[model samples]
Target: MIEPMADPKLSHQLDDKTDDIKKAADVVAAHLKKLEQTQKDAKDDIGSAQWRLKESQIYNITKHFRQIMNQYNEECVAHRDRCKKAIKREFEISGIRRTDDEIEDMIENGFPGTFSFS
Candidate 1:
């Protein structure tokens, strides 16, 4: 039986790509952390409806948060795609798309995020 040849030259490129991806993921994880903290603090400040102005502001803030979260979802999809592509090119994987649940789990576990991953 014959063994397949490997491209030792590509190893450095793969390492570099992996490093870049990990750095970008770190930045994303940090942002998610801050966003989660903001939401928690806002929720903590939610008093009774007597403070009409505060309630109104909180409503607006929450709306903005929702909109931003929608964008975050899109970003997560894009990130997964990029990771899949890079992994495919670097590691020669097949059928390399990450499931939504798996990506979410990875971000929640190995990486980091604001919300409780419960």
Candidate 2:
């Protein structure tokens, strides 16, 4: 049988990390929407030199943002993997065997069952 975590704070910390990732995602999404709007606005002035300059600038900015987001995603994945390993180790020490899918669910959704020590 699965048991509650020995320390409840660990669960909160994991949730905080997940929340940070979600916040980053929201920021990226908002920036993309703004970029889309800028592109749409530029379409009306497509023939102007000024519009060309703006379009080039926008392209460069979008490229940079994409690179940064990619790096952030990579870091998040690494962190997640580390968390999974730590969680698996904890379960192993507790003499509980959990499938990878089950562990993932606990990480992604927070611990499902009670978290208090019996």
Candidate 3:
């Protein structure tokens, strides 16, 4: 036998659907918050990584500069002494000794046109 339409059963079903929707919304909200936090953490991590990379680059450049400086440091004195001796020997042979400033000035301004290796 068909019973008369009862509104209360339909109301109960609607309330249940509403409750399910609310639960689903809450779940989505939680996930969204987690996603946002994850993105923020990742951004912070990238900043930290960038700083470390820069630090490593600075360290490598300093190491290379130190290596080059050390290589030149060992020979600088010997090289200067050799140049001094050669310049002195040349002056002695020429029967002249110019002042240091004169030699430096000549080097800076170039020798006179009359000067020749021969």
Candidate 4:
């Protein structure tokens, strides 16, 4: 029954890598927050289109809103992917296993956004 000795160098390297990943994740999370807010605002604008009196005005407003919404959606997806990659990199570096759903939940719930692990 021999116990393995801990490697101090490896521990320090893992800590450094974890810090780097956490920093990257924080950046991505901030972008995700902005994208999420923009997406919500776009949805709100589109939902308010019911006040239009003229059909042409409604069509134009709807079209504009749709375009804005589409752009936000695209940006949101991009930010989400960025966060996903960061999390994946962290997992690889730290050897922490997390499911896709867990990673998504973290971003959605603003877990890594503030870089507040507590």
Top-lDDT candidate index: 2
Segments of candidate 1 deviating more than 4 angstroms: 1-5, 44-118
Give the lDDT of residue 95 in candidate 3: 76
Per-residue C-alpha lDDT of model 3 across residues 34-111, encoded as one tens digit per residue: 654554566555568765675566556556655655665455445444444455456668778777776556433433
On lDDT, the stronger of 2 and 3 is: 2
TM-score of each: 0.34, 0.62, 0.36, 0.44
Q: List the residue pairs that clash in candidate 3.
A: none
Q: Please report, in order, the local distance difference test score of every candidate based on alpha carbons.
A: 0.51, 0.69, 0.51, 0.55
Badly placed stretches (over 4 Å) of model 4 are 1-54, 113-118
In candidate 1, the residue pairs with backbone N, CA or C atoms under 3 Å apart (3 or more residues apart, or in different chains) clash, namely: none
So what's the TM-score on candidate 4? 0.44
Best of the two (3, 4) by TM-score: 4
Between candidates 2 and 4, name the one with more favorable TM-score.
2
RMSD of 3: 38.6
- Please say which candidate is ahead in lDDT: 2 or 4: 2
